[model samples]
Target chain A: MSDDFERNLREHLHSEAEETREFPRRLRGRIRDGIAPRTRARMAPQLALAGALVLVAVAVLVVRNPHVIFTDVPSTIKSIFQQPTPSPTPQPFTCTDRSGGTTGASSQLSTIRTAPHDGYDRIVFEFSGQIPSYDLSRQDSATFVRDASGQPVTLDGSVGIKLVFRNTDAASGVQADAKPALISVKEIAQIGNFERVLSYGIGLASSQCVRVLELSGPARLVVDVATTASASTTAAPTPLPTQPAATDLGQFSCLDHSGGVDSGSAMQLTHVRVAHQAGFDRIVFEFAPQPGATAHLPAYTLSRQASAKFIKDPSGQPVTMRGSAGLRVVFHGASGATSYSESRDQTPNLPVVQEVAQLGDFEAVLSWGAGLSRASCLRTLELSNPTRLVIDVQTP
Target chain B: MLMDPTLGRVIERWRDGDRDAFEEVVDRYGLQLLRTARLILRDQALAEDAIQETFLKAWQRIGSLRDEDPGPWLTRIAMNESISTYRRRHRFQALTERFGRLGGGKVEVSTEARLDLAQALDRLTAEQRAAVALHYYQDLSVEDTARLLKVPVDTMKSRLKTALRRLRELTGSDEALA
Candidate 1:
């Protein structure tokens, strides 16, 4: 019966009688914007005149107070207007306080290890059940002591605290079933530039921090609060070496633009190194596996430009660029901080580059400029291979 | 704010002077608009007009829409406008017929076969009419039809089932419309 009913409806819908089912051409886009004729006709001239006035006003404002017009942008985009000047984190120093001093709190001072730098401060505390929110505003006696510069520093902004809770079985010491818990925070007070982080005690109630309500019960909670402040001249920082300005090397394909050939043939660049004296400041190369080639070039090396100069191998030896076989390029700093990585497969060709030719599977172009410091340049080129032909960046 | 990639995004883009986006929207749902309008007016030309007015109103007032789905919103507007036009035309015809009778002349009232179908339609209530329209013509499910009508699913189902039986008895057809 259902089948017959569906069949009948389909037949009725497709029959010649239903030829009128298609929407009228004249009413196509017109139907979506159902404006009344009288209002539309009347509003047209007035709207045009008003629009002209608005444009004129905008132009005049731009000519007079250009910054004001630009500043009128949404807050989300306006935040980007500030220059990214790196403000150093202040170093933490121990001091004896006359008030609010506690032996229990003093013992907990060694609980957290923070990054050593000026203008940095870190405090650690532990609690059971839900993590208690700290109210910095309540610390009215808080004051910043200057080193030698006699400059008084303030808490730069809001501090972020990491809350850690233990999860374990009570008797079995295994894992226990839990409930999803969430922490609700409210703004209690603001003192100085530091907004007090206030959290209501969850007590025995389940929190978002724990999966099992029972495990979250009587759990040891740890809170690590890190703060940053502007540097003071009292304590002189270490003198750094004078570095040269970075350069932007012009067009150069990381991978030969010519799609690589079969498994036997790999994309090869004989003499590739930093061309500093040249007009180009940076070298960007697009690479892809040879077309229809399953074979992979695990790595490649960049010899120094002086020895391997304009002829054979500039630096003499090749810096291995490898994924599975060998490491590619130079890796510096921490162990996880790799300066160079390889493409797992090929990234989808971008439409902009597709106009040139159907090239390899993916493309990677690295750029370095004269303004970029050595560390900054290395950090920028530090590619982390998360996917095929894809390298994501980790902010330092 | 995140980009509204669904109906809300389409409407937002249209509001932002992207007339081409409106055309894309039209291409996607034009037939559905006509079908929904036709259910009320039951006339192709008038349904097209209603559909046109519906889209026109949608373009103008789309900025005021806080919700995401434009389908139910557009359908409501189209249905209301079509019913308004139908009522106005019917009243005008009735008035003309009354004047003809006062002038001592027999009015030539041409009854359409569709009118007989309409009379059978009148057996059901107004809510039932909307339920039938949304279910069969608009091709909406019970839940969606309920959402469009601002009624509970069970209420909508009851209205539809009752409407179907009323229609069957009026037309004397045991065969279901589905």
Candidate 2:
């Protein structure tokens, strides 16, 4: 390594360090206000009594066993005084069960980092364990529903994003709610922590393009939302239909939007996500990579049918679902047999889309049927980076 | 180490419930701690926040201080707080790790001097940056840096060595090696 380079680094640090010379006025006042409580707590007699008892115990132990004084005194004293050090050994990582499975699988969310940049505001969530898988969706309104309590949480701002983090301990050292002091970001609050699923809601002044990414080297989930200036430039993964509901257009026909190049191995299906917006409901079929295979989506198709009946792929066994109408969704060259672990059948009974059932998971073809209340116009989108297929069903 | 009699007097008064007596120590070391935190965090506001937290912690434990000179103890707290803040904001906007290379991050360069070293230091990973800051700015020994960062001494040395290699490459000074 270059000595000049090291020299310059040292010089730069020292010179730059001189910029701030004094504590701010606010800090001094905070210190003055804080002194009283600490001083009072220090003067409490309980601690002195405890200290005396501990000394007496040590005396008796040493008298009873003199060899411990020579061999273990330093270690015993150190253990009592010092902070407990975390074990250096790492725990084996298993996928956090989506249905609120094992506590051993859950990781603590240690810190939340946020900032506003030229075109986007970023939020990075730091976790003690591996960065947990998450579900991200844009909501039509800032009205959030708490997970377990089913209480209504009205947040600030016009539009919002709802995030559900799976296998996270909600009891971690994080703020219950915060206004993230960013340029365009307005508010963020923990909606609930139910069964190891921790949910947070981010409210923004208006709708914006957003993206979520998983980063390693101290596992973090990065959420970036476009600011007003950069909204036009930041390309969304896929655009959702935001026009007024067109029940007049009537036909729930969908052109085949899900065919793609398949690699050596089929995509591994992971989680199934659902969200509700104004006039529409959406289901996201998210996938993770089968080892040695790239993260990708398979060829998929969505079609509307009159009856809530579907035949299992290859098996041809008909499965009946709820609702007056039905939607058949199929992904070719994909199988959920190995990767997908979440519940296969879901009964989320929303306004337009009521239930979803796994029609088949055989011979490299994974299929699901969406039970709809009525025939509705729907849209499909393909997104990457933890590849997902999005199906949005419009309400009549 | 011989205790400074004057510093001893100050510690005693502070232990006896004089608020300004502790604030006096803040006056002596506040700038240095801020500078150390600033080097690690790269954001002056966050550095100030770290220093404030350090001072508050020191205030709480000041009475039980085993020694007169509080420099090393205060620096240790500041290092922990700065590293904690750094882990949270590595790819943040106020000071990015020159994230343009990291795909989703952006770095804004203001001054020539800052651009030179900030870009070079940003090339180091968070662990490397902490190693360098503790070893260089806070003047901690490699063993102490390892102990504070909770790594083996050899690991600390490796991180510092890797950090220097990265800095050398960023500076285009590839002439020397050990």
Candidate 3:
């Protein structure tokens, strides 16, 4: 390589390096005080023995008198034990409108603010008057629609929470059209109607548990969404389920019954694509319309298989896929009348999914297999209109 | 390579257990280590981890290093750590696959220039990538680069030759290499 090439490469790499802000300062302190890795390795056995002893003691106590363990345990120990395992399950949060009807007086939504906390992000909607009675519900996608015009309102996240406030308007102290205050809350669409209800759609990065709180002085409605699975909490009295089994279907376990199957026409699988996201790898199947078709969404089953092999059409030969682990997705209500042209999409460098293959559309029970680098947490979403079946496998 | 007298004293003091001296070493070499690791690993967070582990190891074994200047030694450690991290992470993913579990930066360049270089760099093997990083970015001579990589000088020369050829092909910059 010439000196020019070397110099250019150096300049190129240097330009891409992130700004060296506090790294040197921060690393300097850590190096000064940090324990040596070898020392840590040397101490491992002793630490393991100590840990085992404590676990043994705790088990014996629980067997001897379980109630005593809970009652006499230190708060710190209790908190540690109570710290919820980060599961993708949505925690239940419900706040009913206490005010029977609109108070006849309208309140203006003044300012929107967002702040990040330890495990959650908060969005506060400040109002000029009394906090309005509202209804909030989670949706598969956060696109808010104008109730009057029925046009879809675009928001930032795949998942959303719709907030509808009664006898409120955005016209008073704030702009009628205002963007969301935070990245997680994609957009705050103001649906000001003459009747009484003022609605806003809150978009989120992904599905998260939302907690609604009402505060006074200058009245405000605050929503807190867990930024991470572990950060999720519920103000409701229901105790969470114990840690799920290793193979438990996490976020995909819940059934979204909102869009009923169109029973009239057969659904045609049109296109398939795969992409990697921040926390998961996604496979999308697009479905096309059949005239007078009432689409039926069959109860699909997702399972991991030992090998990435599928029985080929007509030949009866097994086709091997690119990954070590194979995910078989069988859509029950699909029509086999229109056979899909088999295609394989490869994403070799991704952490989870490696390849996605259209195994067979035999008998309209559309089946596809995804070759994953490893077994992963899998979730599915069925979107309507230009129907799409989305499967997201979370990277560990 | 020229040695900094001040950095040389700091290395001696660090070996003698002066914590402030270690800080000086970090201040001087931390960014360079980070840049080299980032080039090798192609991920900012992973690069940071490799550099951190490298420095920690350097601190632990500071007494054993007899070199008057610590730059090359530190760079070698950082390079090894980055490559190790890349392999270890991929190995963990492969292991988890058998059990059927799915688990799983900076530049001053114009965004486009940096992106073009990053994409081109991704095509090289890890050995080639490391050799280029140390030789070009760190300005180590071919002999020193070979020594740091623990390969023959001719082997280092071949690696650089192939890496630059591949990069030029990818970026369509034959003239730049010429």
Instruction: Tell me, by TM-score, which candidate is best.
Output: 3
lDDT of 3 by residue, A1-396 (tens): 356665778888666664443254334434544532346579999999999999999999999998878786877687887996453343343321112212334787778777877667778888888887565666666666786788887776776777777667765555445454553555555654545567777778766666666777678877877676655443211222323442343454221213335243457777778887766777877777677655545446665555666544312335687777678776655654464554544554577788776665554456677887765545677777777777777665
lDDT of 3 by residue, B1-178 (tens): 5555655666677888776667667756787788788888887767877888898898888876876678878887887898788778667643544354233211123324533667989756667889988887778899999999889999999988988876766676764446
Candidates' C-alpha lDDT? 0.37, 0.70, 0.66
Ranking by lDDT: 2, 3, 1
In angstroms, the error of model 2 at B170 is 2.9
State each model's C-alpha RMSD to the native.
30.7, 26.9, 28.6
- How closely does chain A match the true chain A in each prediction, as TM-score? 0.19, 0.37, 0.39
| Per-prediction DockQ | 0.12, 0.18, 0.14
Candidate 2 — which residues are off by over 4 angstroms? A36-396, B90-115, B147-150, B175-178
Looking at model 2, residue A116 earns an lDDT score of 90
lDDT measured at residue A384 in model 2 versus the true structure, 0 to 100? 89
- The Cα error of candidate 3 at residue A134, in Å, is 39
The TM-score ranking, best first, is 3, 2, 1
lDDT of 3 at A379: 65
Instruction: Tell me the tens digit of each residue's lDDT in model 1 across A1-396.
Output: 245433343344334224453445436523322332346578899999999999999899899989877666556455765656343343332111111111112111112222222233222222333332121111111123232243443332221111212121122221122111212211111112111211211111111111111112222232211112122122211122222332231112111111111233333221112222221222222233344734333232221111111110111112222111110231111111122243322222221111111111211212111111111111112112211121111111
Candidate 3 reaches a DockQ of 0.14
Put down candidate 2 lDDT per residue, B119-152, tens digits, no spaces. 7776566667778887877677889889878788
Candidate closest to the true structure, highest lDDT? 2
Q: What is the lDDT of residue B113 in candidate 1?
A: 28
